[model samples]
Target: MTSPDARMLASQNIVLILCGNKKDLDADREVTFLEASRFAQENELMFLETSALTGENVEEAFMQCARKILNKIESGELDPERMGSGIQYGDAALRQLRSPRRTQAPSAQECGC
Candidate 1:
């Protein structure tokens, strides 16, 4: 992830997730979990190991990413009004998503965090 392309995205304030998929294949692993964890920690990124076959942590990865993005938007770090911010309230869910009642962040139990 230290590549130039990744750096360009970081320059754009993109929220990145370092996902190591196929977590069920522990026997054929080439990279260690500690290595990935250290890299993610050093880079200030969200990381997860998911398994498509077992459906483990797959949904959690997406949910975590969405939560981070929503938090960023709520904190005014990411502006939905700004172009290229990669954030927008869709027309179908706009009203519900932007409802004033949803101002508070979800509880840990609610978010499964």
Candidate 2:
């Protein structure tokens, strides 16, 4: 990626993690975990790996990204009012308003009971 792209993404504080290829057993086709980790250390981004076939580490990767964003927010490092800010708690009044429940058909046993 170009410097401008990196800067733009960084300005938004979006966690950009590179997942390398699991196809190569030699582990040189793409960026490895070590390299991503180093990059994360330098750029203050969250780094992780995931496998699509086995469905491994995918959840962990998302959780790691969420935790990093939350940590930045908690530390006052990121402003929630910013456009790219991911911290959306929504309006309190919206939560207070409840949706109407749907009616369901009951079995014959319910009528006797």
Candidate 3:
């Protein structure tokens, strides 16, 4: 199937994050990524990829999506006061998303090297 039109998709405030289940098939799905990325880049729609099996770049992918959504809101792409305006995300959701995660970083206590 052909990739969805980015222009049309970007007109709305919806960001589509598509993750390919099979790594082997991802290469064949270049057109989809190309179209999606192009649409995101041109219209500031967030597009990203992640791997649940490998847990690769999963956080970054979601963060990128969040960032894009935030940017869209900041840019007035979607009305903040208007609920569900063209798939508008809630401020509370964004606030939770922007909150810092409590992750312990590697320190000398944990690393002998």
Candidate 4:
């Protein structure tokens, strides 16, 4: 199920990262480093072992993903306006919806109250 999803995302030029987390508990690790690395290589995805507890490689992983996204954006490979791109630039309506001014209720005169 997940493999097909990954393939579909890959086909759509999405950046993928296969993360093996919990490096802080290396002794309790079930999946070996080699296995995870091999899987990531086979799937053509970037691999990282991160530890949220120790903050090891966590920032690197995010930076790598962000860099890839920025590269794609710069190269025009990824369009923020494209459907299914998981990004949306605010249109006028969307901007209005997000604007703080919209939070205020209309005055009684404006509402004809």
> TM-score: which candidate is best?
1
Top-lDDT structure, candidate number:
1
Of models 1 and 2, which has the larger lDDT?
A: 1
TM-score of each model, paired residue for residue:
0.75, 0.53, 0.45, 0.66
Q: lDDT order of candidates, best first?
A: 1, 4, 3, 2
Flag regions of model 4 displaced more than 4 Å. Answer: 9-11, 89-113
Candidate 4 C-alpha lDDT tens digits along 55-89: 99989998999888766766667766678776555
lDDT of 2 by residue, 3-102 (tens): 5576665566665555543533445546656776787677655555667766667777778777776667666667565576655547856432233332
Looking at model 4, residue 4 earns an lDDT score of 72
Candidate 1 is scored at a TM of 0.75
Q: Can you list the residue pairs that collide in candidate 1?
A: none
lDDT tens readout by residue for model 1, 1-113: 75657767653657778888889999999889999999999987889998999999999998998888777776678777777777776785563544333647888769735
Two-way TM-score contest, 1 vs 4, winner:
1
CA deviation > 4 Å runs, candidate 1: 9-11, 92-113
Better of 1 and 3 by TM-score: 1
Lowest-scoring 10 consecutive residues by lDDT in candidate 1?
A: 94-103
